[model samples]
Target chain A: MITIDGVTKIRGRTRILHEVSFTARPGRVTGFLGPNGAGKTSTLRVLLGLDRPQAGTALIDGRRYADHDRPLTVAGALLDGSGAHRSRSARAHLRWVAASNGLPRARVEEVLDLVGLSADAGKRAGRFSLGMGRRLGLATALLGDPPVLILDEPVNGLDPAGIRWMRTFLRDSAATGRTVLLSSHLMGELAETADDVVIIDRGRVVAAGTLAEVVGEHATLEDAFLDRTASEGVSW
Target chain B: MTGPRRVAGAVHAEAIKLITLPSLALTVALTWALTALLGLTGRPGGVLVYTQVGFLVLGVLAATHEYQGGGQIRASLLAVPRRPLLAVAKIVALAGIAAPFALVAAVLAGRPGATGGLLLDLVLAAGVGMLVKHSVGATGLVLTAYEIVSPLVRTHLPEVARLPSSAWTAAVLLVAIAIFARREA
Candidate 1:
C-alpha cells in the first residue's frame, strides 16, 4: 500500500505540490491521471524519497521509502527514461541495480525474459527504440519483485501490440496483489486498465475514487478529466 | 546485504560504468600515447605536467558520465538512495581505475615519484567535474587552471605556488563530497 498524506513540495518560490494526498491500495491498479505539469511526477518523486517535501509524508507499507533496508524489495519504481546509462547494455544495467539491493544476479536475466527483452539484453540502451526503452525500464522495476510498482508515462512510445502487452501485464501484476500506481495522460488507457483513479490538476487533487465514482455523470473518463481540470481554468 | 557488501556492489557497478565509456578508453590511450611520445623525445619538461590532462579528463568524465544524454543520475540514485555511500563508491571506483594508470605513466616518464601528483590531479579533476556537472565545461576549466592559471601564479606569486597541490586537491575533494552529499539527484 502507498499513502501520500498532505505532501506539499515547493520548488524555489513556486509551489509544485499543494497538500497532495492519495492512496494506492494493494491488489488494485490505481491510475494517477493528470495533464502535463500537474505534479504527478513530483508526487511520485516525493513518494520514492527522491525529493523531500516541505509538509506531511509519503509512505509505502506504513514506512517512508528511505526507511526500508531493501527498498527495491518493498517498492519498485520506473520514472522517466530507461534509467540506464546510454552506453550500458540492458543486462549490465539490470545487473548493477540488482546488485545495489543485494538481489541475485540471476534475477537480471529473469526480468529480461519477463519483459521479452532477453534477445536485446546485450544491446546498449541508447540504441533501443522508445518501446524497447520502456520495456527495459519495466524490466528494471520488476528486478526485485516488490509488492508495489510505480511507473510514470509507461506507454509514451509503445506500438499497439506493446500497449496491449503492457495493459495485460499491469492488470496481471495487480491481480497478483501488487499495488500498481501508474501516471499517464492517456485517459482511454486508464479507463481500460485502472480499477481506481486519482486525478490531479494544478498541483491539487481534483477528484479521486473508483472508476465509477469519479466518472459519475460524465460519459467517459476523458470527459470527466476535461470537465474537472477545465473547472480550474488552467490550460493543460 | 551488509553495508560493506552493498558498497562493494556499488563500486563494482561504478567500475563497469567507467570502463565501458568510450571516453575512458579514448582519454587513457591518448594520455599514454602522449606521455610515451614526450618520454621518447626527452623534451619532457613542462609537457609531462600537461599529460596529466588526459587523466584529468578521465576523472571529469568519470564524475559527469551519468549526467550525459538523458541522464542516468536519477537511475543511480533510485538504485542506491544513500548519497554518501554512492559518492564514496564513485570515489573508490575512480581511485582504483586511476591509480594503476598513474603509476604506469609515472614510470614511463621516468619520474615515478610524480605518481602521487598525478593521482592528486585525478581527484582534483573529479572534484571540479562534480561542481561543474558538464564534461566539456569541467575539462575546459580544469585544463585552464592547471596549464595556464597555475603556471602564471607560480611565475608571479612564488609564495602561493609553494602551497602543495595535494592540499588544494584535498580541499576541492572535500567540498565536492559535501555538495554531492546534500544535492538532490
Candidate 2:
C-alpha cells in the first residue's frame, strides 16, 4: 500500500504541489494522470525519497521509503531512463543493484528474461534504443519483485506492442496483489488500464476516484480531464 | 539500523560499478604505465606526480560514473537510502581500488611517495567528484589545489604545505561527505 498525505512541495518561489493527498491500495493499479509539468514526476520523486517535501509524508506500507533497511525489497521504482550508466551492460547494471539489496544474482537473469531483454542482456545501456531503454528500466524495476512499484511516465518510449505488453504486465502485477502506481500524461492509456484514477492539474488533485466514478457525466476520461482542468485562461 | 551486511552490500555494489567502468580500466592501466615508464626513465619524483594525477582522475571517474545516466544516482540513492552510508560506501569502494593500486604504484615508482598518501589522493578525488558532480571539474579542482597551489604556498609556509596534504584531503573529503548526505540526489 502507498499513502501520500498533504504533500505540499515548493520549488523556488512557485508552489509545485499543494497539499496533494491520495492513497494507492494493493491489488489494483492506481493511475496518476496529469499533463506535462503538472508535478507528476515531482510527487513520484518525493514518494521515492529522491526529493524532500516541505510538508507531508509519502509512505510505503506505513513507513517512509528511506526507513526500510532493504528499500528495494519494499518498493521497486523506475523514474526517467533506464537508470543504468551508459558504460554498463544491462546484466551488470542489474547485478550491482541486486548486490546493494542482497538479492540473488539469479534474479538479474530472471528479470532480464522477464522483460524480453535476454538477447540484449550484454548490450551497454547507452546503445539501447528508446523502446529498449524502457524495457531495461522495467527489467530493473522488476529486479526486487517488491510489493509496491512506482513508475513515472512508464510507457513514454514504448512501441505499440511494447505498450500492450506493459499494460498486460502491470495488470498481471496488480492481479498478483502488487500495489502498482504509475503516472502518465496519456489519458487513453490510463483509462484502459487503471481501476483507480487520480487527476492532478496545476499541482493539485482536481479529481480522484474509481474510473467509473471519475468518468461519470463525461464522455470519456479525456473529456473529464479537460472539463476539470479548464484553467483560468482564454479557451479555444 | 543498517547492519554491516547492508553496508557491505552497498560497498560491494559500488565496487562492482567501478570494476565495470571502462574508464577505470583505462585510468588504472595508464597509471601503471606511467609509474613504470617514468621510474624506468629514472625520474622517481616525477613518477609520483603522474601517478597521482591518474589516480585522482580514477577517483573522479568512480564518482562521476554515478551521475552519468542522470537516473543512475537516483537508483543508487534508492538502493542505499541512508545518504551518508552511501557516500561512505562510495569512498570505501574507491579506497578498495586505490589501496592496492597505490601499493603497486609505490613499488613500481620506488620511494617517490607514500602509498597511504597516494590512496588518500584517489579517495579524496572521488569525494570531490561527488561534490562537483563532474569528472573533469572535480579532478581538475583537486589537481590544481594539490599540484599548483600547494607548490606556490609551500614557498611561504614550508612546514604547513609539506605536512598537511592529508589534512587538506581530509577536509575536502569531510565537506564532500556532508554535502553528499544533505544534497538531493
Candidate 3:
C-alpha cells in the first residue's frame, strides 16, 4: 500500500503541491487524474523519493521509500522517459538495473519478453520508437516484480492495440494484489482500467474515491473530471 | 544485498553506460592524438595540459550522461535510493574507465609517472561536472579555470602553486559528494 498524507511541495516561490493526500490500496488500480500543470507528476516524484516534500510523508508498506533496504523490490517506478541511456542496448540496460537490485539475469529476459521487446533486445534505446521506448520503461519497472507499481503517463505513445494490452496488463497486475498507481490525462483509458480515481487541479485534490462514487451524476468520468477541474478555475 | 555488493553493481552499471556512449571513443582518440602532438613538440608540461583536457571531458561525460536524452538519473536514483552509494559507484566506475587512457597519455607525454596526476584530473573533472549538471557548461568552466584562471593565479601567487594538486582535486571531489548526497534528483 502507498500512503501519502498532507504532502506539500514548493519550488522556488510557486507552490506545486498543496497538502496533497491520497492512499493507493493494495489489489486495486488507482488513477491519478490531473491536467497538464497539475501536481500529478510532482506527487509521484515525492512518493518515489526522487523529490523531497517540504511537509508530510509518503510511505510504502508503512515505511519511507528511502528507508527501505531494497527500494526497487518494494516499489517499482516508471517515470517520464525510458530511463536508459540512448547508446545502451535494451539488454544491457536491463542487465544493470537488475544487477543494482541483485535480481537474477533471467529476470532480464523475462521482462523483455513480458514487454514484447525480446526481438529488439540488442537494439540501442535511442533507436527504439516511442512505443518501444514505453515498453522498455515498463520492462524496467517490472524488473524486480515489486508489489507496488507507479507509472507516469504509461501510455503516452502507445498505439490503440498497445493501449488495450496495457489496460489488461495493469488490471491483471492489480488482480494479483499489487498496488498500482498510474497517472494519465486519458479519462476513457482510466475509466476502463482504474478501480479508484484521484483527481487534482492547480496543486490540490478536487475529488477522490471509487470510480462510481466520483463519477456520480456525470455521463462519464471525463465529463466529471471536466466539471470538477473547471470549477477549480482551470480553463480548458 | 550487502552495501558492498550494491556498490559493485552500481559501478558495473556505470561502467557499461560509459563504454556505450559514442563520445567515449572520440574523446579517447582525441586525448591520444593531443598527447602525441605535445610529445613531439618537446614541451613536457604542455602534453599533460592538452591531454588532460580530453580526460576532463571524459569526466564531464561520466557525470552528465545521467542527464542526457530526457535523463536516466531518475531511473538510477530509483534503482538505488542511497545517493552516497550511487555517487561513489559513479566515481569508481569513471576512474576505472579513465585509468588505462590516463596511463597511455602519461606514457605518450614522456611523463609516465604522471599517470596518478592524470587520474586526479579525471576525478576533479567528474566532480565539477556533477556540480554544473550540464556537459558543455561544465567542460567550458573546467577548461577556463584550469587553462586561464589557474595560470593567472599561479603567476600572481607563487605560493598557491606549492599546494599539492591532489589537495585541490580532493576538495572539489568532497564538495561534489556532499552535494550529490544532499540534493534532490
Candidate 4:
C-alpha cells in the first residue's frame, strides 16, 4: 500500500505539486493519470524517497521508501528506462542492480526470460530498440519480486505483442495481491488494466475512484479523460 | 538496506558500471597506447602523467553519461537517499577504479616512488570529472593543473612537495566529482 498525504513540492519559485494526496491499495492496479509536467514524476520521486516533500509525507507500506531494510523487496520501480548505461549489455546491466540489493544472481536470467529478452540479453543496451529497452527496464523492476510495482510509461516503445505481454504481466502481478501503480497517457490501455484510477491535472487530484465510477457515462475511459482534461482547461 | 552495507552495495554497483563501460576499456587502451608512444619519444616523465589523462576522461564520461540519461541522478538518489553517503560512494568508487591503472602506468614509466603520486592524481581526476561532467573538458583542466605544478615550474620546491601535479589532480578530481554529482541541478 502507498499513501501520499498533503505533499507539496516546490522547484525553485514554481510550485510543482500542492498538497497532493492519494492512496494505492493492495491487489488492485491504480492508474496514475496526469498531463505532462503535472508533477507525476515528481510525485513518484517523493514516493520513492528520491525527493523530500516540503510539507507532507509519502509512505510505502507504512514507511518511507528509504526506511525499508530491503527496499527492492518492498517496492520495485522503473521511473525511466534510460537509467542504465547504454554501452553495457542488458544482462550485465541487470546483474549489477540485482547484486546491489543482494538479490540472487539467477534472478537476472529469470527476469530476462520473464521479459522475453533472454535471446538478446548479451547485446549492448545502446543497440536495443526503445521497446527492447523498456523490456530490460521492466526486467530490472521485477528483479526483486516486490509486493508493489510502480512504472512510468512502461509501454512507451513496445510493439503490440510487447504491450499485450506487459498488460498481462501487470494484471497477473496485481492478481497475486501486489499493489500496482502504473502511469501512462494511454487511457484505453489503462482502462483495460486498471481497477482504480487517480487523475491529476496541474498537480492536483481532479478525480479518483474505481474504473466504473470514474468512467460514468463517457462510454470509454479515453472520452472520460478527454472530458476531464477539457473541463479543467489545465495545460501541462 | 541500512548503514554502511547499502552504501557498499551502491559503491560496488557504481564501480561495476564504471569498469564495464566500453569507454573505460577504450580509455585504458588509449592510455597504454599513449604511454607507449611517449615512451618511444623519451617523454616518460612519470606514471602519474601517463595515466592521469585517461582516468580523467573516464571520470568525465561517467558523470556526463548519467546526466544525459536524465534518470541516473534520480535513481542514485533513490538507491542511497543520503546526500553525503552517496557522494562518498561515488568518489570512493571512482578512485578505486583509477588507482590501479595509474599504478601500473607509474611502474611501467619507471618513475621511482611515483606510484603514490599517481594514485593521488587518480583521486584528483575523479574529483574534476565530477565537476566538469565532460571527459574532454575535465582532461584539459587536469592537464592545465598538472602543467602549473610540474617539476619544471616548481623546481625550488621540496622533491616530495614537487610530487607530480597529478597527485593533487586526483584530489581536486575527487572534490569536484563529489560536489558536482551531489549538487541539485
What lDDT score belongs to each candidate, Candidate 1 first? 0.88, 0.88, 0.90, 0.76
3 versus 4: better DockQ goes to: 3
Model 1: DockQ vs. true structure = 0.54
- What fraction of the true interface does each of the listed models get right, in terms of native contacts kept? 0.39, 0.79, 0.68, 0.43
DockQ of each: 0.54, 0.74, 0.67, 0.46
Summarize candidate 2's per-residue lDDT along A1-236 as a digit string, tens digits: 99999999999999999999999999999999988898999999899888999998999999999999899889988788889998899889999999998999999999999999999999899999988888888888888889999989888988999999999999999999999999998999999899999999889999999999999999999999888887664377
Superposition error at A162 for model 1 (Å):
0.7
Q: Clashes in model 1: which pairs? A: none
lDDT of 4 by residue, A159-199 (tens): 89988988999999999999999988888889889999988
Off by over 4 Å in 3: B37-46
lDDT of 3 by residue, B32-52 (tens): 988898788788446777888
lDDT of 3 by residue, A1-236 (tens): 99999999999999999999999999999999998989999999999888999999999999989788778889988888899889888998898888777888999999999999999999999999999999999999999999999999998989999999989999999999999999999999999999999999999999999999999999999999999988736454
- Model 2 global lDDT (CA atoms, 0 to 1): 0.88
**In TM-score terms, which candidate is top?**
2
Ranking by DockQ: 2, 3, 1, 4
**Residue lDDT tens for model 4, B1-185:** 56667877778877877777787778777877776677667763444465556655666676555554425555556555555665667768877787677667665666647666655555666666667766667778767866665555567667667555665664665566456544653
Clashing pairs in 3: none
